[model samples]
Target: MNWALTNYERLLDLVWQHTWISGSAIALGFALALPVGWAAYAMKSSPHGAVRQLSGVTVSLSSVLYTIPSLPLFVIMPTILGLGWLNPINVLIALVIYAFAIMVRGVVDALNAVPPSVLDSAAACGFSRGQRAISVTLPLAGPVMLAALRVVSVSTVSLLSIGALVGVSNLGSLFTNGFNRNFPTEILTGVVLTVALALVFDLLLVAAGRLLMPWNSVVSAGGSA
Candidate 1:
């Protein structure tokens, strides 16, 4: 802690870079996930079995993207994107892909979890497809979607650390710096701050979800009663 305090300014700069790289990727990933998730859910809900097959295939590809080894991706992203080897943009893009992969499937599952009766009720009310999706489906699915956001945010923050191995300046750089100097404090600081960031982000998502959809809790409580 003393060592960290001594170098607190440097640490703050790294934190800002780390947060920017990871947070931007997460934001982009979440934006892309909405449509991908909707497509998966829409196909699955369709009567055509072949169209349903596409949904499974889409999600499987996302899972595959996530399973790729991170170090190699960091190394190769520069060549693939024509960027400098150590550019933070490479790290950002890589994290975005991973975040999108995780959230897309999660969002699909959330949409699928919407009760059939509620869907039918929405339809009976003469709700158009767009209206039902925006008003009824997304509102009811908020809990699960927010749960996905929590997981994706944490995962993105953690995964972005891997980019530091290739010289991207995030919190993960502390591990490298500590190792080179054989100083445990730097490494420990990284671990603590990274975990703290993840926890804070997760809690914010939970709070936002509850605030945005108070009716969800009310209905859940009534259902239990």
Candidate 2:
């Protein structure tokens, strides 16, 4: 407890850095997943099936990217992006890669979950591919996407702790600092703070989804009755 109080300011700074990094990764992943997912789902009728093949390849590749251990990826990012070993950007990119790997599949699944009949209706009403995608398909897929966002957001917060291993930028540093000095309170503080961060993110995602998709809650309520 004394160690935690003594290091409170530093701990707060690390907490802010950790949150920022986690949020950036999730945001980047959400942005990139949209197009990748659309391509995977929409490229089915291309000549010689090249685009479809590309879709499969992308899913495979994202999975492989995520399978790489975080420590090695963090260490290797300097070579991959020519950034310094401790550059927060390296952690950012690696985390984004991980978030994307996890969310891209969810995006694909959500988009595909839009019913064929609803899509056909949109087409029959003279909606173009892009129009149907924007107005109908995506709206229908909102719940799934929100669920995916919730999952990825929590996962990103948890993983951001690993950035401390690089001893560069994050809450994980608290653990490292604690262990180095043999301070149990510092270690406990790190664990509690990270868990709090994840819980906060999860709640925010849930609230945002409900706020953005009131119809979903309504439908669920009606179904439950």
Candidate 3:
């Protein structure tokens, strides 16, 4: 605690850097996942055999990509992107790829869970495909999507520390520094702060979900209680 308080400024900077990296990755991953997930969901039900197989291929590909070891991926990012080894962009891009892999499958599952009857009703009420997707389908799928997003948020926060291993400053630096110095206090501080950061992100996501989907809050309350 004394160490943390004495180095409060440094700790705060690490926290901010971690937040920026994790938040950006989550945002970019979701942006990229939406269309791909939707396409996978849409294509899986297609009459064409080859087109239907594409969804399975995509899900498999994402899984394979995710299985590549994170440390190696971080180290290899510079080689792949033509960036300097220590560039934060390498870490940022790696995290985004991971988030996308995790969330894209979730998006497919969430969209699949939407009721066909609801979609038919929306169509009957004169909603076009785009309009229905924006107003009806997405809203109906929001709870599931939110659940997936919360997972991504927590996972990203936890993983952002790995960037420190590659010389991109973040909370994980505390781990390496503490280990080198044989300082248990610093290592424990890092663990506590990392978990706390992940929890904060999880709580914020839950609050946002409740605000955006009040009915879901009611359902969850009733179901849990």
Best-matching candidate per lDDT:
3
TM-score of each: 0.94, 0.91, 0.94
lDDT winner between 1 and 3, please give it.
3
Worst 10 residues of 3 by lDDT: 216-225
Compared with the true structure, what per-residue lDDT tens digits does model 2 show for residues 43-102?
754676777798888778888887898888888887999987788998899889989998
CA shift at 171, candidate 1, in angstroms? 0.7
Clashing pairs in 2: none
**Residues 1-225, candidate 3, lDDT per residue (tens digit)?**
788999999999988998888889999998998889989999998999999999989978886777888889999999999999888999999999998998899899899899999999999999999999999999888889888888888888888898888999999999999999999999899999999999998898889888888877653434544
- Flag regions of model 3 displaced more than 4 Å: 219-225
In the range 67-169, model 1's lDDT, one tens digit per residue, is: 9988898888999999998789998998889899999998898998999999999899899989998999999888888888888999888988888888889
Kindly report which residue pairs in candidate 3 clash with one another: none
Clashes of 3: 0
Q: How does each model score on lDDT? A: 0.88, 0.86, 0.90
RMSD of each: 1.7, 2.3, 2.6
